[model samples]
Target: MDASSGNSAFNNSVAPLEGFDKDMLSSTLSQTQALLEHFNISDIEKILNMSSRTVSVMTQCYCSGTLREILLSYKSVHGYFSLVVCVFGTLANVLNVAVLTRKEMASAPINRLLTALAIADMLVMLEYVPYACYAYLVLPGEINMPYNWAVFVLFHCHFTQVLHTISIGLTLVLAVWRYIAIRFPQRSHILCSDRRCNVAIGIGYILPLIVCIPSYFTFKIQATVVFENDEMIVLHHVGLSRMAKEDDELLYYVNFWIYGIIIKLLPCVVLTVISCWLIKALYKANRRKQALKGYTNCNSASLLPSEKRAVSKSDRRTDRTTKMLVAVLLLFLITEFPQGILSLLSVILGRCFFRTCYYLFGEIMDILALLNGAINFILYCSMSRQFRTTFALLFKPRMLAKWSTPASQTDVQTTYV
Candidate 1:
C-alpha cells in the first residue's frame, strides 16, 4: 500500500482507537475498573456464601443463582412448576371474590361490610400474590431489569400491604357491625346502613394507603436479618439501600411495631372484646326468648300441640342466621387471632429464643390470613338463604326452584358482620 493511502486510512478510520497500544489499553481498563469499584454490587458473592448457612436454618430458602450462579437458572421447567403451584392460590382467591360480590346478599349492614372485604381480597390475590410468588421464589436470583423491578416494588409496597391492611380493617368493621346488630338491633338500621358501611370500607383503604406511602419509601427487595447468634429474620423489610445512616435500623424496627400495633393488634383486640360482648348478648337474648316461648307453650299445651310445633319451627328459622354468624366469627378467631397473639409473643420472647420456632408459627398463622380471603364465599353461601336464591337467580334463572325453601324462623341466617 502507498504510504499516503495507509496514513489516510489509519487516521480516518482508527483515529479514536490509534492511542490504544498495549500500555494505553491497560491504562484505560484500569481507569474503568476504578469507576466500577465505587458502586459495584457484592450481592452475588454474599448470597453464595449465605446459602451454606441455609442448612442450619429452619425456614430454608435459596435462589438458583444471581442470574449466573445456578446452572439451570433460565429453564422454562421451573417457571412452569411455579406457575402450576401458585396458580392454585390465585384460583382460590378469585373464587372467593366472585362468590361474595356476585351473590345478592340480603339488605343487611353486615353483608355490606363483608361485601367490601370480599372485593378487596379479590383485588389483592389477582393483582399481587401471583407476581410475588414468582419474584420471590421462581425467578433467577436478583432479577433486576428496570421494568420488572419497578413492578415488583410497587406490588410489594402499595398493592400487597394496602390490601392486607384493608382486609384486616374490614374484618374489624364486620365485627363492629355485628356488635351493633346484636347489642342495639333496635337502633341498628339508624346507626348502620349499606351507605355508611360503604364509607367505612373506603376509609379503611385510605388510611392504610396513607401508612403504606411510607412503605413505598421503605419497602424493598425481600431480605434476611441474621443476628450475631444466627437467628434469621426472613420477611420483607424496608430497603437498606435507601437508608443513609447506620443508626436508622432501630427506627425501621420501631416503625414495624407501630404498624403492627395499630394495624394488627389494636383492631383485633377491639373486635375480639366486642365480639365477646355480642356473643354474650346473643346468648342471653336467646335464653330469655326461649324461656318465654316455653312458658307460652306450656299454657297452650292442652289446647294445641300442632300449633306448638308450628311455633317451634318459626323460632328455629329465626335463629338460623345467628348460628351462621357464630360460625364465621369462629373461623375468624381460628385464622386471625393466632396471628395477633403470636406477634405479641414474638416481640416479647424474641425470634431466636425458641429455636426459630416463631418463623414456622408465623407461617401457620399466615395460612389463616390466606383462608380469611378463602372462606368469605363459604360463609355467604351457608348463611343467607336469600343470598343463595339470588345467586341462583343470577346464574340460572331458568332453573329457579319456585318459592324459597321454608327457612326455619330461628334459622334465619343473616350476616351480622
Candidate 2:
C-alpha cells in the first residue's frame, strides 16, 4: 500500500478514466475516433511524423469520448520492446534495494550514498513503469491524457531534464569519493565517513532542484510548425515562458554542455588523475616493502612460484572495482557521446534532417543510463567487503554465524555465494 512501491492493476486499469474532464479533455479521444475510422496504425505514424504544432492542434480538437483511440501507440513491436526493457530494469532495481535494505547491512558513509542511489533508481523505475504500461495499452492517439501542450512539455520533459542532471552529478560524486579513498587514503576516514557521506548525498540531490528551477520558470513549450514544402511535423520548441520570447534554446544546449563538462568530463579527469597517482604510490610502497625484506636482487631475473597463487575472490573484486568504475565511465561516454553530439547539432546545425532522430537517439541513452543503475550492485559487491557480508546475511541469516570468523580467516566474496 506504500505509494512509493508497487504499480497496482487498479491504477493501470483506471488511469485513462481518472484524469479526463468534462471540458478539459478531447485530444486523444478525437484521435481515437479518427483512428477507428481509418482502422490502420500506419496512418497514426504518418500523423505522428508531422510537426508538434500540428499534432497539438490535431489533438486539441479531437472529438471527446470513447476508447480504441490512437492504435499506432501500442501497435508497434518497438513499443512492446521498450515496455519490456523498462519492466526488466524496474524489477532489477527493486531486487537490488530489497537486497540492500536489511537490518544487518553495515552502515558506511559510502553505503549511504549507495542506498540513496538505489532509492533514486527505484523512483526512476516507478516513473517508467506507468510509462511502459501506457505504451502497452494507451496509444498516443488513444491515450486519454489532456492536450495542454504547454503543461505537458513542462511536466514531463522538464522533470526528466532535472533527473538526467542529477544522474550525471551523482556519478561524479561517487568518482570524487573513489578519488579521495585511493589518492588520499590517510584522510579517507574523515572525509568519506558515514555522517559526511550522507550530508554530501543530501546536498547533491538538493542542488539539482535549485539549479534547474530557472528552466521551469523560464522555459515554455508549445506545438510549433516546421514545414518544408507540403510536409510538416509538429515540433516542440523550448523557448521563453508564457508570452515571453527568448533564444534560450541555445541556453538549453549550453545547460547540457555545462552538465557534460562539469559532471562527466571533469570527474573523469579527476578520477583518472587520482587513479594514476594511486598506482604510482602503490608501486613505491611495494618497492619499499621489498627493500625492507633484504631481498635486493635488482638485477636478478626472479621467478617466484608463490606470486602465482590464484588471488582470493575478494581481492580480485576490490581491484576490479577500481577498473570497473573507469570502464563504466568509458562506456557511458561511448553511449551518451552520440546523443550529446546530435543534441548540439539540433540546436547549432539546425538541421531538419536530424530532428526526427532525437527520440530514437535519446531512448538509446536512457537504456545506457538504466544499465548503469543495473550494474551498480555488482560494483558494490566488488568494492566493499561489508556489502558482500551484509548481502549474504540478507537471504541467509544462518550465515551470520559464519561472518564471525576473524578477518584473516574470512573469504569475503565466497560468503556472498
Candidate 3:
C-alpha cells in the first residue's frame, strides 16, 4: 500500500473517534446540568448513593431503567387503583347514606352523623379520580390533554379541599361524641340529641369552609411556559408547588401549622387519646358487669333480673360500637400520618430537602388516604351486625329472603347506638 493511502485511513479512523468523544462529553454535561437544576445538593456523593439505591429497587421491582419511567409506571398503576377506589367508595358510601338515613336508623344522633360522614366520603372519592388522572395521565404527557380539561381538573382542587376538610372534621366530631358518651354518659342524652347532631353537622361543613379560605387561595391552579420538543407549551399546576419554589416563608409557615397540625396531627392525636379512653371504659364496665353477675349468687334478692339484663346488654352494645369506631380512627391515623409528616417536613426544610423522593412519597400517601374512605364501609359491615343485615337486605334481598324469615326481624334490631 502507498504511504498516502495509509495516512488517509488513519485520519478517517481518528476523526470518527474525536466526534464520538465530543458527543459523549456534550451528553454528560447536559445530564449534569439537568440534575443540578432539579436537585440542590452540597454533597453530590450522598445524592449519588441515594440515587443508586433507589434506582436498584426501581429497576428490580418495576423493570424500569430510568427514574422517569419508574415514576410514570408508579403513577399509572396507583392512578387507576385510585379510580377503582373512587367508584367503589362512591357506591359504598351511597349505600351507607341510604341505610343510615332510613327511618329505622336516622332517629339516632350517631347514625345521623355517620350519614353525613358517608356523604363527605363520597364527595372526597369522586373528587380524587380527576386529580389523579390529571397528575398521571395529563401532567406527564404535557401536550396531549386539551387545555380546557386541564383547567377543569386543576380547578377541581378547591372543591376537593373543602371535602377533605369536612371529612377530617366529621371524623373528629365522631371521636369527640364517643368520648363524651363513654366519659360522661349522663350528659350524652342531652348533649347528643338529634338537634345537637344537626347543629354539629352544620358546623362541620361551615367551619371547614371558613378555615380553608386561605387554602383555596394557596392551592389555585397556576399557568407557566415550558419547552418540550423545542417548542414552548403552557402548563398548569397546583400553586402549592410554585409557592414552595418561590420560598415564600410566611406561606410555608402557615401551611405547616394549618395543614400539618390542624388538619392532620391534631385529629390523629385526638382520635388516639379518645380511643384509648373508650377502650378502658369498656374494659372496666365489662369487669363490673362480670362482678355483678358473680355476686348475684350471694345477693340474688337485691338485684332484679330485668335490671341486670338491661344494663349488661346496653354496655355490650356501646362497647361494640366504640371498638368499631376505634378501628376507624386507627386506620385514618395509619394511612394519613405519612402525609402529615411529609407536609411538615416539606415546610420546615423546603422542597429541595428530599428532592424527587418527597414528591413520590406524597403521591403514595395520597392514595393511602383515599383508601381510608374506601375501606370504612367494610369496617362498619364487619363490626356491626345491624349494619351487615341492613346491607344484606338492601343489596341482596332475594339472597337474604331465603334465610331471613319473619323471626329474623326480631333478631335484627336497629343500629341506633
TM-score of each: 0.63, 0.61, 0.75
Question: Per-residue CA lDDT of candidate 2, range 309-369, in tens?
Answer: 2333433444545555555455445544554454444445442312223322333455555
Task: Decide which is better by lDDT, 1 or 3.
Answer: 3
- Candidate 3, 86-184: lDDT as tens digits: 899899899888878766667778888888888988987776676656654444433332456535544454566567778888888999988888778
Candidate 1 lDDT over residue span 16-72, tens digit each: 111113333333432433422221112222222233264245222322225223312
Q: Is candidate 1 or candidate 2 better by lDDT?
A: 1
**lDDT against the true structure, each candidate:** 0.48, 0.47, 0.60
Model 2: lDDT of residue 382? 68
Off by over 4 Å in 3: 1-73, 137-146, 226-232, 240-249, 297-308, 396-407, 411-415
TM-score of 2: 0.61
TM-score of 1: 0.63
Score candidate 2 by lDDT.
0.47
What lDDT is reached at residue 75 by model 2?
36
- lDDT, candidate 1, at 379: 70
Best by TM-score: 3
